[model samples]
Target chain A: MKGILKIAFKLLVNDKGKFAALLMGITFAVFLMVMMTSIFSGVLRSASSVVINIGAKIWVMDPAVTTVANSIPMPDFVQHAVRSINGVKFAVPLYSGSATLRLANGAYQSVSILGLDDTSLLGRPELLEGNITDIFAENGFLVIKDSEINKLNNPHIGTTFELNEHRGVIVGIAKVAANGLFGMPTLYTTYNRAIQYIPSARFTTSYVLVEPKSVELVQHIKDEVKKMGYVAVTNEEFRENISTYYKYKTGLGTNILIMTLISFIVGLSISGQTFYTFILENLDKFGALKAIGAKSRELIIMIVFQAGFTALTGYGLGVGLCTLMIGLAKMRLPNYASVVTFGNLGIAFMMVLIIAIFSSLIGVRKVLKIEPFDVFRG
Target chain B: MAKTAISAHQLVKWFGEGDARTNAVKAASFEANFGEIFYLVGPSGSGKTTLLSMISGILKPDSGSVTIDSTAIWTLSKDELADFRLNRIGFVFQDYHLFPRLTTVENVAIPLILKQRDWDEAIQEALRYLEIVGLKDRAQLPPFKLSGGEQQRVAIARAIVSQPDILIFDEPTASLDGDTGKKIMSFIKDEILNENRCVLVVTHDSRIFEYADKIMKMEDGAVTTIENKSEVK
Candidate 1:
């Protein structure tokens, strides 16, 4: 078996150009699989970052709020109902609104405005510059993500802009997980102050952010809030809800899945054709092997060794390139949200293995049917 | 006669179907004893190679049986036949069929490796065969790097590495020049043919007929006559 594999390796490497072409095919497939799935995963992560990046243990919202990205604000009094629940450590009304901020150059850019409670400041962006206390100033202050600084006309500390004719001052610059997928900057302000910045029909809160006394009490609190005729979800459950909505309802999942399948097909064809041709070209040699007493099993093992080695080498390089791209993006683009999770790596591996097995079987068909007598025909 | 190493009776093989059917070999009966180089000589389409293939256990005869060393080769199970071939028979081809990617030594070690022998041990034994064939210095060179004569020597080294009881060569000297052909034939006769082995050669090259102890002449898929040389002269 070891000698069989050694022969397989020697044969594959003997022709450098063909080996490279095979490797290239596999690498391109793995690259496509990893990159497409990663972008989809990144989009999901960004969609759920509202729940994931915040400090809340549970969320209370209107029953119609299916996704964090498309939430319908609940009545303000829902916070009172959540605060009354047993095992609830605290409850605060959280405000979220989208508005156009007029820049110093007179251009208007859209931004997501999040309003945390004035007293608790429940979901403040981590301060990279300036003071967290400045949102409580009399004139009102807003915190902007560092990635969105250009959208605010390259604002420095204490630069002020206008939103819906209301004066919006940038008190701090902070690092947030990712801006929305369309590069929408996020601005943080006090709950009441945010309502004044966005033109709306009523002053309603999007969600009630609740902290439970213990992780064990989250279920108890969720049930109590549900009794008030509202939907209650823990942070992880909210993240899943948002991910599922984007995955199914918006057709993003379908697009990524199609791309993944196309990549697999491309890989299969390239590998299959190359391996079949390779075997055909080597048929005389295989006949020679058979003539010299090599079993069919041994020949099959040799072909499999060739396929598996090709798949693994190409996969490792593909995955390595994906990681390098993501790392560079993270360092260069603050709002770049492409996540390559372990699940994505596992799926890509499975894809390559399938390609390996498929191509090997295809190549093996020709070898198994070879007659040792063929070599003697002059 | 010295103990018969191989005996075949009334072997028949056909190709294709309907009007295209043609007998490649028919009712071919022959016996070869140990310690002699037996030659099958004929023109193209005379079924000389086909007969060699059948007797070497590479092709099954349509209606007859081949017995090698007191065992009916055709009656064994498929795996057993394979084992028998690996342990007892060695075939050298006309094209030399050396894997171009492997060195001469690696090519020679294939039979031992197939028998589940240790790799290092197999290579050592292969080197010994290479030495016997007068190509030990070229053991590390691939087939394409060797001259035609050297490649033939390497193929011979590969054939006899396992010390198989039956050795069959299909036009081994067809690809070589007259001098090279004679040299290879002389080497096989002097170094490889022994009392414990039966050596069979299929060839139409009449220049090296002096190396044969027996020559079976064939025409139109049937053996026409058998000549016993008794000695090289």
Candidate 2:
């Protein structure tokens, strides 16, 4: 086995130009698959981050609300109906709205405003550089993620911006996982301050976040909230809803899938053609091996080993490159986080493996068809 | 007779179909014995190579039985036949079908590798064969790095590495100069051929005819004559 594997490796690397070309093709294919799929994964991750980070047991919203980013505003009375449910421990009015902040340079940038409960600070961002009390200071205090500081002109504690011509001061720098679907910077503030920041219609709240008395009662609360003609979902369901909405209703999922398939085909073509040609070029050698006592299974084993080695090496390089690019992108862009999860790696590994198995089979069939006597004819 | 090492009974092989059909071999029966260097010499396309192929278990006759060492080769399963060919038969191609990617030592190690021998031990055994073929110094060089005669020697080393009972050579001297061909022929007759192993050669090179213990002359897919050189001289 080791002998054949050594021979397989030698055959692949014998021709330097061919080996390099084969590796390049596989790497490019793997990179395309991983990076393209990861972008969509990252988008989905970001789309659900707000709900995921809030950690609410149940969310009550206007029945028309499809995702956290696109929700219809409900009157504060919705919280009262939600709090009245049998299993509801407490319900808080949650406000979410989009606003354009006029930066220190007078440039406007879009931001998502999140309203946390005033007394409980139920959805407070993790403070990275400022005191929590700074969020309640005078003049519409905004607690922004430290990662988003550059988007807000690298403001200090008192540096101010304007949202809807209302004075907005950055009083706390916090680390938060929330990212809007369209990659808008997030602004965390008290519920009352959020209403002043982005005043809307007669109904101000977008959702009523509920804390179930017990984890087991979440489903019962959701049923009660539904009876009230509202859409109520547990945190997991909300995350799934947002994911399903973006993945299927939009073309994002299909586009990523098509791109992944295209990459797989590209890898297959490049690797398969190179391998077939390699086998053709060395057909006599394989025939000689067969004539000299090597079995068809042995030859097939050699071909498989060659294909496996190529796939594994190319996949490692491609995934490493994709991770590096995402890492660099995250460092430069505030909202770009890696969506290449362990699941994504498993998928990519399977893709390369398919390419390897399929391509090696092609080569194997060719070798097996060769007559050991043909070598003598040459 | 004389303890036949390989026997082919009424072998028949045809190529193509209908209008393109051509009979390559027909009822070709022959037996080669151990302790002799046998030669199958014939005109091109007269089925000398085809007959050799059938005898060596490389090709299955359409309507014949080939028994080597009392085992009906064609009757064995594909895997069994493969193992039989690997452990019992050795072939040296006319073009010296040495793997270009492998070094001389590695090329010689293939048979042992097929036998699932330890890699280091295989190399050691391959080195012994390489030394026998006078290629001990060229063991680490790729086949292309060697000269034509040297490459043929490596092929010979690979062929005999496993010390199989039956050794078949197809046009072994077709690519070598007169001196080199004679030298290779002498090496085969003097060093490789033995009382327990049979060496079969398919060649048109009359210069190396003196090395054959017996020669079977074929014409138009049938043996024309069989001559024992020791008695003929």
Candidate 3:
């Protein structure tokens, strides 16, 4: 067993091209999954950050607050009731509405307007090209960096804009927006100012932020808030909730699930078939091993190790490519976009690995059937 | 008393079934003592390789049995057969089936490592055997980097590295040119005669006749003749 392992290891390192291709294939798959999931997670995180980053220890929102990227708002009384409970430091009201920003070219790009209090505590851009608090001025508003500016022929920072029947100044240009959620640029302004443009403000979008006395009190705090006819969720839980919804609801989960299954089949066919072909090509070698007193189990281990090594290598290279991809996305994207995660990386690796190991079984079965005697006659 | 390294008593092997079945080895029986160069020679499909495989315990004979060092080789369990092979038998093939990914030294060390020998010790012994084959310089290069002749030498090194009591060769020189083949034969003979290790070779090349201590010819599925082989071919 040790002998076989040593040989298999050496074999993988010897053929640089085939070995590298296998490794890269695996790595690329890993990288793809990791980067895609991470970016997806990152993007959704940014969308939620509108509320997530507000120093809020807990989030109180509508029952459907599983996802906040496009979460509908609840009544102000609910926010007040949750705030009234003990251990709540403060609760602010936040709201979001959608509108179209007109480019000088007479074209329109969709943008979501976020309403914040004068304290600016509910939700705001973490990274912005201009000031976030400037939204306090009735004449002031924040437009996402990607909005009508670059996409619409580079609108100036101080460009005047019309939205929701309210003409407003671009007091500040938010540096980054999240592309994963709603597929629209974002704008930020005062809650009162936002109410003017959106009559639906009577229904508050989300409770701004909460600060617990201590981390240990988070659960109790959440329980008390949840009892008030609102959902209380931690930041991480909130993020996962939104991701889970997108992953399950909207049938995106189904689509992704189908796509994932398709990828599995494709990977299995390509990697597995290639491995089988490689074994067929090397039948003679297997014969030699048999004649040399190698057992069926030993050969099985050998081929399996080969396939596993190839998949591992490919996964690694795939991950490397994904890393480069993430770097590129971070550089090229205007919004705070994310790619894959380590967990996603592991998933891709395991999938490719399973394909690899599964694919090698065919060769192993064939090798086991070879009669060492037949090798001598030919 | 010196024991025979291998003994076969009316061993039979068949293939397929019903109308498709064919007897590959018909009631073949033979024995070779330790340190003798035993030859099984015949044309293609003459059952020379089949008999060799049966005696080597690679196939279970349909009838009779094979005993190597008094152990019923073909009748033993699969693991037992493997253990016997690991501890007592070595094999070389015409194609030199050396792994393309491994260096000569690594290939040679494989058998010993199979027994869980330490890496350093296995490598040293492998190098020692490779040195015997006069190819230590090519040790680090992958088998592909070497010539067909060099690769065969490496295969020899790998086979003999574990110092098995019996060494089997399947058309060991079939793929080599005449000169290289002759050279390999001489090397094999020297190792057998000097080291006292049993060498069984199945071949059509009569040029190796002078190297064998005894030669048997298989005309059909059984041995037709056995030559003393003391006289020069």
Candidate 4:
């Protein structure tokens, strides 16, 4: 088997032109696939940024809420009811709404506002400057320093802005776990101030953030919330729900899937055609080997080895290229949201394997059907 | 008495089907012993190559039996036949089908490699056979770098490296000049042939016919004559 593999390797690498063509086909396909899927994953991550940064164990909200960004405000009674549940350690009303901000320079920008519970400040971001308690002061809010921070001219602790023509002051500079995807800066304030400054319907509580007393009691709390005509979901389940909504209900997911399928087909066609041509050109040599005592199984192994080696090499090159491009883009453009994850790599690897198997089957059929007599009779 | 190395009985082969069918080899029978060079001579379309294919366990005979060294080759399973061909027969093609990408030594090492010999051991054995063919110095060169005669010698070395009991050559010298052809035949008889092996040569290149111990002539699809050349020589 070792000898046969050596022969297979020599046969593959010795034809420099064909080998390079095969590698390039697979590499380009993998690059496109990983790039598309990684961008989609990063977008999905950003879509649920609020859930990720808040770190709440359970969220009680109206059943229609699909993503954290599109919150459906529930009446205040839902928060009261959630707090009254037996397993609930604590529950607080959270107000989430988007408002236009008048920057210090008089330029206007859209910003997402999160209103944390005034007493506990349960979801307050970690402060980079100023004091978290200062959020209680007159017109005081915390500004998150993220990729979209510059849209507000890079606000500091003393920066003042206007929301709905009401005076607003940044008391703290803070950072969160994830940045928003819609190119909007985020501001943190108390629930009372958020509703006072930003006009909304009478139902202003967007979600009721809950913390269960124990992990075992989360399901019981969810069942209790269900009876109240609302939904309760753990953090992970909420994230999955957001992912499912984006994947199935939006054009973004379909576009990415189509691009990935195109990449796979491009790789398959190029590699399969080139491999078949290689086999055709080497038909006589294969026939000679067959005549001289190479088994059908050995020949099959040789074809598979050749295809697998090319596919894996191309996959490595593609991943390396995508990583380098993403790194360079992130350095030059801070908002570039493409992440290389294990899931992305696994998807690309599986596609490349399919390409390899398809190419190998093409070669295997040609090689096994060869007749040494026909070759020699020529 | 000399040992019978290959014995064929009433071999038949046909191609196509129905009205399009044509007999390629028809009831061809012959025997060759160890320690002698046997030549099968015929014109184009005479079924010489087809007959050789059936006897060498490559093309299955439509109706016949071939016994090589007392083993009825047709009765063996497909894999067993492949093993038999690998260990018991060495074939030389008319075009000297050397893998152009491989160095000469690697090409010659194929049979030993097929036999599962260690890489280093197979190369060493191949080098020994290359020396016998007097082309040891060219072992590292690719087949394209060698002359027609040298390439033919590489094919010959590849064939005999495994020391199979039967060495079959299909029009071995068809692409070579007369002097190179005679030299190849002379070299094969002098160094490669022995009392334990049978050498079968298929050719119409009469220039090297004088070296054959027996010549079997065929016309159309059947054998016409078997001439014992040893007595004349």
Q: Which numbered prediction scores highest in DockQ against the true structure? A: 4
**What tens digits encode model 3's per-residue C-alpha lDDT throughout A247-307?**
7777665665566556566667666666676677678777877666677878888888888
Give stretches of model 2 more than 4 Å off: A103-107, A146-148, B230-233
Per-model chain A TM: 0.95, 0.93, 0.83, 0.97
**Candidate 3: CAPRI quality band:** medium
DockQ head-to-head 1 vs 4, winner: 4
Taking the tens digit of each residue's C-alpha lDDT, what string does model 2 give over B1-233?
57898888999999889999988898888888998899998889889999998888888888988988899999888788888888888888898888787788998998898898888999999999999999999999989999889988898888889889899999999999999999999999899999899999999888888999888888888887888866534
Interface RMSD of 3: 2.1
Higher-scoring candidate on TM-score, 3 or 4: 4
Model 4's number of clashes is: 0
- Please write out the lDDT profile of model 1 over residues B1-233, one tens digit for every residue: 69999999999999999999999998999999999899999999999988988898888889998999999999987778888888899888899899887888999999998888888899999999999888899989888999999999898888898889899988988999999999999988888999999999999898889899999989999989888765423
Winning candidate number (TM-score):
4
lDDT score for candidate 1 against the true structure: 0.86
Predicted candidate 2 versus true structure: per-residue lDDT over A163-271, tens digit per residue: 8878888787777665655656677888888887686888888888888899899888878877878888888888888888888988888988999999989998998
Q: Compared to the true structure, candidate 1 yields what TM-score?
A: 0.95
Q: Residue-wise lDDT of candidate 1 within A1-378, one digit each (tens)?
A: 786777789899886777888888898899899998998899888887777766588888887887776668777778887888889899998887788888777888888888889899998888888888988875456556656567777776778778888877887777665566657777888988887668776647888998889999988887887788888898888888888888899899999999999999998888778878888888999998888888898999999999999999999988988888888998898777789999999999999999999989988888988898888884
Query: Which candidate, 2 or 3, has the higher TM-score?
Result: 2
